[model samples]
Target: MNGTLTTALAAGLGTGLALIVAIGAQNAFVLRQGILREHVAAVVAICALSDVVLIGLGIAGVGGVVRLWPAALTVVAILGSAFLLTYAALAARRALNPSAMPMSENATTRGRRAVAATCLALTWLNPHVYLDTVLMLGSVGNGFGDLRWWFAAGAALGSLLWFTALGYGARLLSGLFTRRRSWRILDGLIAVIMATLGIGMLTNALR
Candidate 1:
């Protein structure tokens, strides 16, 4: 309500969005789900909720604990890489197989449970989420002193808005994806993004 609060909130909003708008495995997955019109709500909710929790923890200084335990992140990095690579392979196969596109007659809708699990893994398993939301946002929020809660709220709101728009707004573009080549291009992009992130994680974790 105060000037400080407003400033912190705005700062948090801009910062939060900037971090999430980057090209990454999570965004790619969400975009894919959105375009397919399959499990969009579930994917959006999972990603948004995960960001809120992480933002809260960061504001609460839990990033310190994470920093003290390097092995924890290493484990996550490894697991995340494996999951990403697996998803990449699937995506690549889809890109190469015309009948495998989600819009195809033979395409299958993944179960909600599977979609939820994949969303969770994409969100939580990535070490960059920890670094950006937990460490970066947490550090910045805490610097706000007593207004850190407002900052967190702003960040949380940003997450909710971003994922919601990305998930649902993707539908507007769904019409464009009806063509087989469109789906192929999308799947191919997803494959490259996921594989690059996976290999990067694996390389970082090993070193």
Candidate 2:
């Protein structure tokens, strides 16, 4: 039993890390907030907690229900694609306006409320979050049968670790991002990522 539990935990951790490590809009937002050093803790908390809830639901068999109604994902895909495209446009605009890329204390400061809102939106509005955490992770966890809860716990730990590291570890890149050019590059990459993801979802939905 002990060996089986350990295997399940390791499997969950690996799966969680593999899915979360991708460069999605949520991650891009988190990275930007981390670089700006604005409301990092709040952003991290919202993202990590949101994952916990979603993963819990998934392991509880919400994944099977979601799979039964493919139309629900279609709706999510459409809405998520629209949101990503809008965010991509904003990121592109920011990239073009170097004046907006300053890392100075005065320039980077943003309201905690606004930051939290964006963080939540980025996490919750993305359809991939549902597909990954709720459906994929949940389905995988169920494979553990009676030990599925252990798998969920391990996945949740992975999320907590990843977000904590991403939110705090980004400060280490502060020196590099001090330049407007660096910010431009980062924002440009974000724009590309968002656009690509949005288009991909749109395509998938239409299929």
Candidate 3:
């Protein structure tokens, strides 16, 4: 690629990776699944592909149509908050009930369908995601003039690589997660993250 396109690609990759490679409910879930070694591929695929689709829509300016309807974001905000808070409660319960969990392979796991649905919910329900991928990324892409598609491709690739690394690389932590106390700590952290995000969303929507 030419220097300009390469610049756009690098910018997109850096921006996208910066946004996604941090603490979030989705990352928490993926990390947990990775530690469990259950449905890791499916979870990673869902996150990566969903990001690509959302990024594509944003680059195409579907976000403009979304802006014309404030009610839509408001509705999504409310729903997302509720979903996150509910998930937080569940995670708290798991934290408190650590005795019920074991890291053994034969231990019960969430069914593939259930995990997929939750993965979708966690991905699609968050308003912050729309702001990040749609509005923010779109604005950045537009700043590139004619090379925006190259930028979009880089952003999408960054997301895919990050999720793949996070989901699969979590196996390295299997040793730590093998302990029940570690599981409790993880669940507690997830609870806190989810609750914070949920309350933040709810308050913003109410305003």
TM-scores of all candidate predictions against the true structure: 0.98, 0.94, 0.96
lDDT of 1 by residue, 88-185 (tens): 99999999999998889999899999999999999999998999999999999999999998999999999999999999999899889989999999
Q: Model 1: residues >4 Å from true position, as ranges?
A: none
Error of 2 at 182 (Å): 0.5
Clashing pairs in 2: none
The global C-alpha lDDT for each of the candidates, from Candidate 1 onward, is 0.94, 0.89, 0.90
Query: Whose TM-score is greatest here?
Result: 1
Mind sharing the TM-score for model 3?
0.96
Which should have the higher lDDT, number 1 or number 2? 1
Prediction 1 global C-alpha lDDT: 0.94
lDDT order, best first, reads 1, 3, 2
lDDT of 1 at 180: 94
Stretches of candidate 2 off by over 4 Å are 104-108
Pick the winner on TM-score between candidates 2 and 3.
3
RMSD of 3: 1.5
Candidate 2 residue lDDT tens string, 1-207:
689999999888889989998878898899988888888999999999999999999999898788788898888888888988998998898899876665634455679998898788778877778889999999999999999999998999999999999999999999998788899999999999999999999999989
